[model samples]
Target: MTARPVSQHAAGTLEQALAMLAPPGLLVGCRRIETGDASHILPGESATILSRAAAARDASGAGRWLARRLLRQLGYGDLAIPRGKAGEPLWPAGVVGSIAHDADFAIAVVAPSETMRGVGVDIEPALPLPPELEPLVLNSRDRLEGCDVAIAGKIAFAVKEAAYKASFPLDGEVLGFEDIAVDLPAGTVTLSNGRRVGVGMSISSHIFALAFVPAGVS
Candidate 1:
């Protein structure tokens, strides 16, 4: 079997998934990366885009490309979005967004940075996280309290990650597994530092969580 290089323009599967989840004010875009397409992606990125190593060029590049299109649709045409100290995308002055990638998938979501503080989105293959991580990610209450629900800990992990991405820019605070906890019943994520963020989940061939907060509100 042969592997696809990062330059192939293979068809992508993320379009319909993104369309289904688009909200009224947010613009979303995604691509399936069979190959990294370095010729275009590298030129589109700068040295400060996460201090990324050569190996990560494809994933980061594809994710950013999708973000660019989404932003353009919202009037941020051909903007140069950089990365911050914590590896977050430094969107235009009034734009907020997030990017995520799996082995062969990448996605981005964006909204006005004024009223909408930030958009956090994450994607994971429909597989269970390893048992070892269950202790670290899932709180004991949500773990044993549930009578008999068949869900892998991956959704919780993804939700926490998404929440972290959306909340960090607003609060400008460092976050950790212990700092953020998932409330399945509430369909929300709570932070130990005193904040509750709204989260929405989508489960198909993949699992996705899109969390958002208004400016100055968590």
Candidate 2:
């Protein structure tokens, strides 16, 4: 099968954006979802998406495709990342990571488990948060001041989702949107369990958000 050609311009832009949002110890990768991206899924990764629709499977495959590439950089050979019972990616021992994708892009971020206790990443369209969702996602504690008013709700929602992902592996508790609080200027999210996670974001054609819990921090 023929491989999709890489776009130098898009790659350069994504690299720049990632550098701005990634912490010092993280390895981040991004890819434009391509037609044959689903072909990258291995047997071990197939079960997770068996019940998903064709398009959803493609997105899942694209995420794993990028994830495997990042893991390879860490000296892990083409390992398959299975989905956890709660739907989180199950990374290899000694590593912590997250994968996220929207209609057009897929992103993955990884770090040594010793350096990062937990990490989560998410992507969404740059559009405004739906009116119905805004009520469900935002609360009095979230601070959106000094942010672009148009996408403020989107930012708050994305960061909260990232924070939930970062915290769930350690806490093993399912949390609601109201269970997370965000301070955009401070770039932090506080979970109801009292854990603090650092957040970073990039907004261009789409919104990309990342949350992390540093080792030794609770």
Candidate 3:
């Protein structure tokens, strides 16, 4: 089924949003707050937000903001946000996860156990690739093959972002587009470090593309 773009503040209600994003059998809940709210409150569960405007710094910044608030609500405590050697965000002990924020939305996923593994989430607003910049992002083979250039560029961007989050916790490696290769048709990514990761992506024609990956396993 084609993924639908969700925007209304009350789109599905907090209960419904949790139900839609959480894995089966996992209890989930969410609360909406004014951007000015001083604090977020949750006991021990993960929470995320899809903000309107002020909450997010930019399209992508919103996602990170939501993720941070969700972490706080989950009872993870204020994140120390240590910089990994590779400049990735690192959470305190007993936590393993990632956050993805975009222009109009933000999301954060957290798991109690390291066993839950590392998680990376990314979202990009849906837009046509700039004709002049397309060639710089895609290789000659892709350009000559008459493939879907726009989709290819988007997938590449998404995969790189996903890989950055997935691999950050392990060694804080800064990954570039050349360091990651994506097989969108197969929903897979191969890193220069010789690790292979699985990806799940949701695409809405006029909205954005969202991708997620669990940490450590790949």
Candidate 4:
């Protein structure tokens, strides 16, 4: 059977992008923008781009552009844009979140109501990892021993990316691949700092992870 394609845009009309991007149970609102035309509309907030070597200028710029647009869409009114000590994008007062952009696409997740303390989202195209680098990233001694190193690496990369996003607001620390461990099935993450974050996965042909922590937590 063929797999379903991931929907790039949030559900509902263009006006509802904020509502659709906002995950349930969180006080914030989120929206996904794919076109360059939307760039001018973005309000406050800084943007970070994560693109492949081949990503076009327009596509790469979309990540930061979309972030600004989403902040304005949610009524943040000219964001105060700050960067964490590790260079992670920091939102203005009363707002906390992260943004990630890849070769073909970009995504911005934000909180309007601030109910959610911190949020992160990451996506990786379904592809095999290089053979040489697999062993370095995988935890071979663990139950992952039997799995293909390429697959393990892909999962590890996705989880770490998600963790990086989730960790942005708690501190400005830059987390290396070795800084966090992911238990895919359990949807949990343990950071080197000893902080635990909750994880959510969107599995399709490609894999995406959304990691978050309640505002009340450190």
Candidate 5:
């Protein structure tokens, strides 16, 4: 899909909103996708391994663009983040990060491994979750106090996705939605494995969720 034009001010606003959700020691960023955004793709970052479709490549490039910038702040220069076997971004040693995008925007977060074990981020439009998927994405244990009724399910969905991404490298196991219990009011998610991940969210411009595992956690 072609990316719609987004004003730089709007992009910056989203980034600012997301920054509030970021914990100490992590860098977060977001940007609007543009035409031929795939040009940001660099050598050593394999697009073919990701997908041949131009749009997919463009989105990947946008995510890496943000990731590289974030990594640079942590004393690293430009580097390649290749796709792992399980379709996750392979960060440099001593660094943990995650990237995600919807059709219009791309986002990334990175932190030193000393401070964080893993970090996951996701961006989604501020839209309601489809009715058919609600039962699958939300569970009795999940809580959404103070969240708007219209987009509550969508926020929960984003939180679960980010939580799964944050936990996978640590646990080495795939998880179903049933395996995660989200508590929006508490800003956390608990995996069936008993790992608790801290959750942060931004509702401006888009629904942005960040999930993180602290360094000393099991």
Candidate 6:
């Protein structure tokens, strides 16, 4: 509900708007979503991103096109970012990124591999997470402050998801909700084993979280 900075180029459809709002240190690209058009897919990528579900296909295809554009920024055009067995992006050597969508908006955020150990970003509608899942996600240390239960849940879930994505590339570690605790107001997620990642969360066109592990961390 709160407004975020708008880019002068954030025009056209929802996807177009987000392409202009790439997070710091990232180059984002996006396209209009379409279930019927898989034109955005490149060689060796369709098997990973295209799904039987119409909405899923549209969202994924749009993100792929955006990723390909960002690839241009990296001086590679034919690179195929397939999905791994773990359902994560198979980033080419020296490249990393994340893709996310909320409704009609789909986006890809990419950066050179040496810049980060791992990176991820996610978007959710402003709506809250379901109450029944709260006990499964909220940690004992979490302080929701004065926020409504749903909003608080959203914050925690988004942060945890981002952290998991950011760490997966290097650790290949399957993390449970309790393994990573989220601090909403502070915009951070701390792992149980003493590791922490920087997380940025906000309400722009929707709720979003961008996460990354600094390069020097092991």
- For each candidate, the alpha-carbon lDDT, in order, equals 0.73, 0.86, 0.49, 0.57, 0.89, 0.70
Q: If ranked by TM-score, best first, what sequence of candidates would result?
A: 5, 2, 1, 6, 4, 3
Deviation in Å, model 2, residue 207 alpha carbon:
1.2
What C-alpha lDDT, on a 0 to 100 scale, does residue 212 get in candidate 6?
A: 78
Number of residue pairs clashing in candidate 2, backbone atoms closer than 3 angstroms, sequence gap of 3 or more or interchain: 0
Tell me how far the alpha carbon of residue 192 in candidate 3 is from the true structure, in angstroms, after superposition: 1.0
lDDT, candidate 5, 36-115, per-residue tens = 77878878877435688877888888898999999989989899998888899999999999999998788899999999
- Model 2 is weakest, by summed lDDT over 10 consecutive residues, at 1-10
For candidate 1, report its TM-score: 0.84
lDDT of 6 by residue, 49-149 (tens): 64767667666767777787888888986677787887787777788888776555666778886777778877776687788998898889875565555
Provide the lowest-lDDT 10-residue window in model 6: 2-11
lDDT for model 3, on a 0 to 1 scale? Answer: 0.49
- Candidate 6 versus truth, CA RMSD in Å, comes to 5.2
**Where does candidate 4 stray beyond 4 Å?**
1-57, 78-85, 140-150
Alpha carbon deviation, residue 111, candidate 3 (Å): 2.3
- State which candidate has the highest TM-score: 5
| Tens digits of lDDT, candidate 1, 98-161 | 9988777778988986667777889887688888987787875342234123445888888889
Relative to the true structure, candidate 1 has a C-alpha RMSD (angstroms) of: 3.7
Off by over 4 Å in 3: 1-7, 10-65, 72-87, 139-149, 205-218
- What value does the lDDT take at residue 92 in candidate 3? 66
TM-scores across all candidates? Answer: 0.84, 0.94, 0.62, 0.68, 0.95, 0.83
Clashes of each: 5, 0, 5, 9, 0, 0
Instruction: Give per-residue lDDT, candidate 2, residue 193.
Output: 85
Model 6, position 21, has a per-residue lDDT of 39
- Model 5 segments beyond 4 Å from truth? 1-3
lDDT of 6 at 24: 56
Which pairs in model 1 have colliding backbones? 5-35, 6-35, 6-36, 6-37, 94-113
